[model samples]
Target chain A: MIAKELKRGIITENSIFVLALGLCPTLAVSTSVKNGLGMGLATTFVLICSNIIISIVKNWIPGKVRIPCYIVIIATFVSILHLLIKVYTPTLDSQLGIFIPLIAVNCIILGRAEAFAAKNNPATSLVDGAVMGLGFTAALLILSTIREFLGGNKIFDLMVIPGFQPMAVFILAPGGFFVIACVMGLINYFRGKKGAKAKV
Target chain B: MTDTIKLILALTLISLIAGFAIGKANYRTKDRIAAKQQAARQGAIDAVFPEGFKIKEMNDDGGILPQKYWIAFSDDKLSGYAFEMAGSGYAGDIRFMVGVGLDGKILGLTVLEHHETPGLGSRVNEVASTKYIWFPFGGDDKTKPWFTEQFEGISTLRPIGVEKSAGEWHRLSEQARAGLRDRNAVSAITGSTITTAAFTRAIERSVSKYLEELGGYCCPATRKKREAEAGAAAGENGEETEGGDDS
Candidate 1:
């Protein structure tokens, strides 16, 4: 059961490519591999903690006010994570900046709470959170690697080619959109092909 | 209704727990965060000055100068002054330190904090390098950011010019840099002119005025005259005067 859920979260219901959630932070911080990893881990930490807390308190929370209650839990975790990052990893804290706090509103965390965690057992919810967070991190790594290499002719701040003139646009807003669209399109293509073969 | 009460209770309980957790987290991390910030500030100050320089914090005296500034002394002689300056950039606030020599020329500039668009405006603090990772032989890594490096040796007395057409400072040759220095200008970062302009404008707006006032304060003749005046005024009033020896 855990393996099925893990496979489902990491591939079938992957947050970025499949669900198209949390694009704001993904685009903003995916300029470099380091920033993407930092943001991903920060978001992952928030996701895991919030998922566990919401699952534990799912019984007491009223259906009518569940959203706000979930938000409060998620925000608390994000704030704590923010403070810890600020103290322990000041460089990552500065790099991630507002996106760290903005993780509270990342639909992935709230969406998981409302959709999966609210109804699931704590262990299952924890698994779901971890898988989903890993999925998001995977998507970010792929996107950032492409963007960083194409935009700066470097990977993780290390130069890739000797004196390769990078296309500066790949580091800009338009480039972010272009990269996301292509990646999403590629994922959809493979998924569509697999669905067709299964039906056949 | 009991249903409404339950809703409120649930939210209130969760919020209370969250608040407690956040407060506890803040309490735990506040000291470490402050220490980190202090260390960064000290590092920025040290970067702007040479080795073995002593920093002395000067009282603002509640004068027109709004920011707190420090005077740097080397071997009992005034070396330069360092102060924090802030201005709005393309995305958000950009705060940095500026060190100016006694001659009003900028010694160095370092960005302390900024919230700018990553990969673009943030390049203001980036040290540009052409060194390849595998080869890593030909080009050298830059210690200071090219954007801030260009500001060194530019006089704060004159209005600093941002030449957009001249290209980025790192991309320019030696002759081009010399030409820019002669004209009291620095090349703006491509596609981030606002960030570059904001930093230079901040230096131009604050440093020159503060240096003038600081010069007057450090002048021995003016110091003697001001002391004599303060003494006479204190004798008459029998009380300490404002803006006198408060440092």
Candidate 2:
């Protein structure tokens, strides 16, 4: 159980893909390797930090307003990230564009604040954030790598196909829709197999 | 009453633990995070120039530009300078960096920033289509060509100054200059004339500003070399340097 917390707890493949959290940036900035990485890393930071905060104050939050309280904490962290990125990492701030602030609605952060950290030990929650965030980042990288490869040619400019004429649609908004749909299908297929294995 | 007190105690202990953990994590990673960000910003500056050049000056206009930068070369072979360049592009302000070399070459030109609409007007940085379109073309239409190769080989140093001349236009290449001096010379981007002219005029005015402010921009080398060999017939005749003024 402890080991699982570190591997797939915070940012799980299911939450980000199967359940579909943080779709805004996932679709908007997945056009290239650089944008994907920037959005992934930034979102991870916000997720980890917000999870820890919500866990700390979980008991103090009024039962009637726990949801609103969690949102405020998450929004606060997102705002700080926005300012710091604007001052220090102008390029990425521009690349990620408006999606950065959409972190407020990024269900992954909010969902974890409500589900895992709000009830678990701070240590376990921390581990959960790291692992889950990694899972999300990994999923993003996989999806973007495929989309960029087919849509733009070259994985992060590494040139995987030995020079394929980009499929073109893979880089546009429609391409994002298709890539996410395919990834969601893969996740569902594997998850169903696991469910069957468990039944056995 | 006793239960409430117990709840408060439990909450206090959890807060203490959470605080300690967060503080430590940030302490461990703060240095690395701050350092990485610093390096990235510095890297943006270094991307424009080659090594061995030291920044001899620094200034900023402070209105969105935030900085005006000038760096001189140790060998005196090149002096590249950059100023915040902006204009009312189709969508909004098109922000970019324009760096110029001492030999009148554009050391490098990168659109450092922008806010233009994505699919239609953001092709400014899409170098592949930049030659022809002033704006972006959605997926299937991207590789479809529309630009004439006439503008090929033209760079900032060749025909146009950062500033436009009255009835003047940017010459794409030295070979192409003879045809560009006419007031009516040069056609606009097929579809987005406003954007093309905006970008052209923006770049032309910018290059011209640095040229004029730099005290004497040698017309591009190919032309300069020719003007030198001919001794500028007007100079040999002791007549006024007519075209040299960029009139």
Candidate 3:
């Protein structure tokens, strides 16, 4: 039972890469390690908090108003986080930009609210949120690190090799789409092979 | 009359309850939100000037504070000022924090915020690339090492250097500690000359404002002649006031 949750959160599974969710910020702000971390942490806070609250109120909310309720709860948390980050970490605040508020529509957060939290106890829902958030953050960090290093030839601002011809395109919008394609492609390829072997 | 009265009374009662609840919630959170904003502002000030600063005063026009602040040093030793600098680029607004030293030299600068068109204007953020002001003129900042070097120890008299773009002039003047303000020239960023010039103008204006408005009467030798020119201009305008008031 414990292992299942761990597996679901860690490998054999991923929220962003494998599941193909929250691709907007995954490609947009994941251009740097710092951006990835900031977005990841903020998402985790909103997801966990939203999941817990949505679970508690799931029974009380009319089906018609459920989506709106979840959205309000999520948006409120996101705005608080946005203002908090702005006053505190202005650089990170600016770096994440509009994506910070777009967490309202991140789909992953809302998807979990409907699929997992609405049906489960608040306890499992909270864990599921945290795990999913973590999974998403980890994937973002990996993709961003790859892009920054290959695209800019500097990992976290420390120049490793003196004369590296940075793949100029890797840091732009197209580079972002390309990186997503590659990451998703890899996940599908490996996951597919594993599933095939399991069936055999 | 009886049905109409009953409906009106019911509606009024519901509205009253709704208003009271909303008002009470807003009133409670109003203070909390204000406190949070103050804390956030304090945090930004601390991060920028960890040495600590004084509010000194506050001014605003209306809803959007074009420049939300006017912070000064507590010790009075630090001249110049720190504030949000902004301007229109080829894309959206480019915003940044500019720090000017007492000498009219750029103490430090950091892009606080911006939303330039990606690839074209976004290159401005790539430090060390020389594609933008990412180069540090002569500082420890790896990305912008020494590009701002041109900005250091510059003349506050003429905000725009004469012949060439401003950056080149700053670069040239750095070699010599000439008291004469160089209106010579600085190399402007190609293709994005307008963008580069706009940023330079913002920095120059902010620094000059600090010097003229609040730099006190201690005009450096570089500004000596410009001082005379300014006095002459004031005389021409016939707005010359008596004595000095360092408010």
Candidate 4:
């Protein structure tokens, strides 16, 4: 059961590629693999913690106030994560500056809380959060790898191909959109092909 | 009405729990964050000045910004000054530390903080490394950012120019660097002229004024001239005004 959920989270219900949640941060911090990873982990941390907390308190939380309650929980996690990052990894803290605080508003955490965590048990909610978080991180790594290599002519701040001229536009806002579109299209095409073969 | 009250209570309880958690986290990490910031500031100050130079905080009574400049001493004698200046960048403010020698030439510069565009403008703080991931240990380690390294030896007495024609400092040849030095210019980061210009403009606008103010405090000629002027003013007023020039 856990393995099936993991597969679903990572592929079918992937946050960035399939569900298309939390694209704001995806576009903003996906400039480098390091940054993308940092952001993904941070978001993942928030998602897991918030999911568990919301699920545990779901019985007590009134339906009318559930959204606000979830936000409060997610925001608390984000704030604590922000402080921890500032103290432990100041470099990543600076690189991912405003986006850290903005993670409080990321739909992935709240979406999980409302969709799965609110109705599910704490144990399953924890698993769901972890899987979804991994999905988000995987998508970010894919997008950032393409952007970082094509835009900067380097990977993880190291030179890959000597004397290779990089396309500067790939590092800009438009490049983010182009990469996301192409990746989404490719994923959809493959998924469509697989569905056709299964039917056959 | 009871249902409404229960809803309010649920949200209130959750918020209270959140508040408590965040408060605890802040209380725990506050000191570490402060220490990290202090260490970074101290590191920047050290990077801009020569090794083993003692730093003394100067009085900024008549300066534009208080606690912005510090006096660096070598062998108990005044060697130069280290300054912290902030300028408006493309996205937000860019704060940096710069060390200038007695001869008015920049010893070094290090960007302390900035909020420019990540890939473009943020290159101000980027340290260009030759370390290839494949080879890993093959290339030389470069600690200081190549962008700020070019500012070394540029005089602060004149307007600092930003030139894009020469390309980035890291890619430039020796001859091109010499040409830039001759022109009292630094190569601008590609596609980040605003950030580069803002930095140079801040230095040009404030460093000269700061030096002039420092001259009044240290330079014998300027001290004598200021004293004479003060004495003349005192005579006109028929009163003694000493140590009153600094406000």
Candidate topping DockQ = 4
Compared with the true structure, what per-residue lDDT tens digits does model 4 show for residues B169-204? 998899999999999999998888999998898888
Tell me the deviation in Å of residue B110 in model 3: 4.4
Candidate order by decreasing lDDT: 4, 1, 3, 2
Of the candidates numbered 2 and 3, which has the greater TM-score value?
A: 3
The residue-by-residue lDDT of candidate 1 on B1-247, one tens digit each, is 9999998888898889889999999998999999999899889988888778998776443333433567899998888988777767886778888888999999888887787776678777767877776877667777788899999999999998999998788878999999999999999877788988888887777777667656644643453465576674322221211212121
Candidate 3: docking tier: incorrect
Q: What clash pairs does model 4 have?
A: none
DockQ category of candidate 1: medium
Off by over 4 Å in 2: A3-13, A33-38, A63-65, A79-98, A119-124, A193-200, B1-81, B87-94, B101-105, B110-201, B209-247
Please provide, for model 2 over B111-209, each residue's C-alpha lDDT reduced to its tens digit, 9 standing for 90 to 100: 545554332234344323222122223323332112212222235544442222322122244544545533223434322345445545665655554
lDDT by residue (A112-197, candidate 4, tens digit) is: 99999999999999999999999999999999889988988778888888988888677787899999999999999999999999
Task: Tell me the TM-score of each prediction against the true structure.
Answer: 0.90, 0.57, 0.63, 0.90
Using alpha carbons, what is the TM-score of model 4? 0.90
Arrange candidates by DockQ, descending: 4, 1, 3, 2
- The digit string of per-residue lDDT tens for model 3 on B15-122 reads 454456446655555665567645654543444343556544333221112223445665766454555566566555666555555566555555545664332244
Give all candidates' CA lDDT scores: 0.82, 0.57, 0.61, 0.84
Q: In candidate 3, what are the lDDT values of residues A122-200, reduced to their tens digit?
A: 9999999988888888888888888877776656544434556667577767888899889889878988999999999
